[model samples]
Target: MDGARLDQFDRKILSLLQADGRLTNNDLSERVNLSPSQCSRRRQRLEDDGFIKGYRAVLDRDRLGFPLVNVISVTLATHNRDNAQRFADLVAKLPEVQEAHALTGEMDYILKVVTPDLKSLADFVNGVLLPHEAVQHVKTAIVLQTLKETSALPL
Candidate 1:
């Protein structure tokens, strides 16, 4: 995809924004060594070019009763297009399946999931995932601790 190439100023802007998305234009400008108007214009251009897609508040999953986090690897019966799409649609409707990706090798898909506890996770597997017609097998690995979890993209 052809897009605007990032220069040093753009990289600085991204670095500052990645840390604190809610920074005021004035604050951001000061941090990035640009005038308020210039910073505002640059940020808007970044958004228009799809460099800065959107901003969101990161919430603690534990506070929402979804402390448990795990990665689920799914293997499908076949590599056909229909089966892959069916699997994707099925995973989309399941709230517990936070993110899904069609992958390579033995595992056809990988999912990032969050739930209340191990029992709840088991229930989801038995009640929902296993029942899906396209899913051949599913393997899950629980996350005991997170070493690093940041959405910042290196410029």
Candidate 2:
């Protein structure tokens, strides 16, 4: 639903769910000061209306063997729908590329990539990204420290 149509209770429900998606209906009702049935109906409505997407557990990359994070900027060989589509097709197959964004600036795209180590990162950049016909230049910066990382959106 649109922001204009969301009541205070709806906003609270969204804010609380954003903080913790696993909140049970009973728990959410208690926190939001609403009846359990009301909470359930509202939440279901939100999901039905495409407000709440499907949820998944957030994994720890470091413990899972992918510790290195890199922010890579890409300049495509050409600025055309075909080239952009080709680049999009390439990134879609790469599991290491966690996030990809088409941008408007000096660079055509920015990628958030994760790898196990320096050698693996090098192999990915050299063997995969650079060899792609659509890529003209690739610049990667290894993340030494992450101050804050979250997927939660502000209500």
Candidate 3:
């Protein structure tokens, strides 16, 4: 549904869901001041309309043995559709790459990579990224600390 179509109830539902995706229909209904069935139907509509993509549990990287996080800037050899698509496809297959974004700047793409250690990050950059035909240059910066990190959007 369009943004104009979303009422206060819809907005509240979205806000609550963003904070806690595991909230039950009854709880969400009470928060939004709607009946459970109404809440469920609205939630279903939100999902079908692509506003809510899917639910997933947020995991702690340090606890999961992936403490090292690196932001990598990549420059492609050629700025062509084929090269860009190839690079994107390769990155999608890499489990270490948590996030990748193509940009309109000097660097072709920026990647957020998480690994168990510095050696693993170095190996990924040297072995996989540098060896790619499309990759021209790669610059990496390790994260010292994270002040804040969240996937929630301001509705």
Those runs of model 1 whose alpha carbons end farther than 4 Å from true positions after fitting are 1-4
Candidate 1 at 80: error in angstroms?
A: 0.8
Can you give the lDDT of residue 96 in candidate 2?
98
Each prediction's whole-model lDDT (CA):
0.86, 0.95, 0.95
Point out the worst 10-residue segment of candidate 2 by lDDT: 50-59
Which of 1 and 3 is ahead in lDDT?
Answer: 3
**Candidate 1 clashing pairs, residues 3+ apart or interchain:** none
Q: Per-candidate TM vs. native?
A: 0.93, 0.97, 0.98
Clashes of 2: 0
Residues 36-91, model 3: lDDT tens digits: 99999999999999999999999988999999999999999998999999999999
Residues 1-155, model 2: lDDT tens digits? 58889999999999999888899999999999999999999999999999999878899999999999999999999999999999999999999999999999899999999999999999999999999999999999999999999988787
Summing lDDT over every window of 10 consecutive residues in candidate 3, give the lowest-scoring window. Answer: 146-155
lDDT of candidate 1 over 1-155, digit per residue (tens): 23456777888888889888998889988887889999999899988988888998988899989999999998887778998888888887888887888777888889999999999999988788888888889899999998998788776
Q: Name the better of 1 and 2 by lDDT.
A: 2
**lDDT score, candidate 1, position 91:** 83
Q: Which lDDT value does model 1 have at 83?
A: 88
Query: Candidate 2, clashing residue pairs?
Result: none
